[model samples]
Structures are given as C-alpha cells and as structure tokens.
Target: MSATRVQVVPNGPVLVSGPVRIEMPDGDVVESDRFMVAICTCRRSDDYPLCDTSHRRCRNVSAAPERLGDRIEREAR
Candidate 1:
C-alpha cells in the first residue's frame, strides 16, 4: 500500500489515488478497486461520492430566447 494523493480541481471533483473505501452517512461503504477516483463536491452527481461529470454547467440557449420573448410581452401589457 502506498500513500494516497488527493488533488483539488478548480470547480470540479477531488481527484484521489485509490483502493479507497468511502463510508456513507447511511452506514454504507463504497470501495473502489481503480488506481484513481473522483469524489464529487457539488452534490449533483447521480453517483453519490463519485464524479460522473455532472458538475459541469449547461445552458439552454433556445430557452433563453423564449424567456426573453415572455419578458418583452409582459412589459408591453
């Protein structure tokens, strides 16, 4: 066994070198066999305690146009 290294990413998950066991608040344990793992800090992952790349922000440009139209219509009335 070697020392585990943790790296903090800017606006992203915590990168960890593994063979790590994570104990959940509900008394469940998650074990990883991989050499590395990503721990989610944003709490938006469908895979809890793991990074599924769900922390990335996505914008719907189509919806923005519709919202702008609605605002203009409301102001006219």
Candidate 2:
C-alpha cells in the first residue's frame, strides 16, 4: 500500500488522497472513495470532518501569516 498525501491549506481544509475511511469520536464511520478529499481543519463545517468551504466565511482576515507557535498557543486555550 502507498502512503496517503496530505496538504495543509492556510486557514482552510487539509487536502488528502482519498478512498479513505474515517472513524469518528462517537464511533460512527464515514467513508469516501473520491480521488481526493478535503478534510476540515477549521471546525466550521456542518459536515464535521469534511470540508464544506465554510472557512471562506471567516470575518477575521489578516494580512500577515500566522506563526505555528502562536496558533498552537491560541488553540491550547
């Protein structure tokens, strides 16, 4: 089997190679056979783990790119 590719999009969803199966925290399972999948990272998707382009609705837009350390610190709270 080959390794799956995952690409992180700034302030958006992660793009992943598909034909994947996801096991949710509540034990529900979701599967996708698409060639590629957009996995939600912003937690704004009504689909939960899947991206629905909801991050585009973000009201706070910053000209500066956020540092990884700052993001980690903020999310830790």
Candidate 3:
C-alpha cells in the first residue's frame, strides 16, 4: 500500500498526494491515479468532492467600484 499524504491550504482545499479512492455518499466510488488531488472544503463547488478553484473569493462587480467611489467621496467631504 502506498503512503497517502494530505495537505490543508489556507482558505482553500485539502490536497491529497498519492493514489486515492473516494467513496461518495451515494455509493459511488471515485478513483484517481494522479499524484495529487484537491478536495473542496466549500460546498460551492460545481464538481463536488473536487476543487475546481471555486473557493477563491470573487470580486463583486456590481458593488465594489461603487463602494470604493463612495468611500473616496466621503473621505473628500
């Protein structure tokens, strides 16, 4: 049996190194031969049990610039 290693990224996924087999709640078994895998911690992933980089913080396009401008205006006043 090969040794398995797990790593926890700050504010990110749990990375697993070495061959792994994941058993899902629905009685599904997922197997991988890759050297590393990222398991999602946040439930927002479209690919459950896998890290698709969805855990990264997204910029709020509709509000971020407006909020910055408002803060600058308030500071100027």
Who is ahead in TM-score, 2 or 3? 2
Residue 15 accuracy (lDDT) in model 1: 83
Error of 3 at 18 (Å): 1.1
**Model 1, TM vs. native:** 0.68
**How does model 1 fare in lDDT?**
0.74
- Best prediction by TM-score: 2
Global local distance difference test of model 2: 0.74
Candidate ordering by lDDT (highest first): 2, 1, 3
Q: Order of all candidates by TM-score, from best down to worst?
A: 2, 1, 3
Off by over 4 Å in 1: 58-77
CA displacement after TM-score superposition, residue 33 of candidate 2 (Å): 0.6
The parts of candidate 2 lying over 4 Å away from their true place are 59-77
State which candidate, 2 or 3, has the greater lDDT.
2
Instruction: Tell me the lDDT of candidate 3.
Output: 0.71
TM-score of candidate 2 against the unseen true structure: 0.70
Better of 1 and 3 by lDDT: 1
Candidate 3 local Cα displacement, residue 60, angstroms:
12
| RMSD values, in order shown | 14.1, 5.9, 13.1
Cα deviation at 75, candidate 2, in Å, is: 20
How many clashing pairs does model 3 include?
0
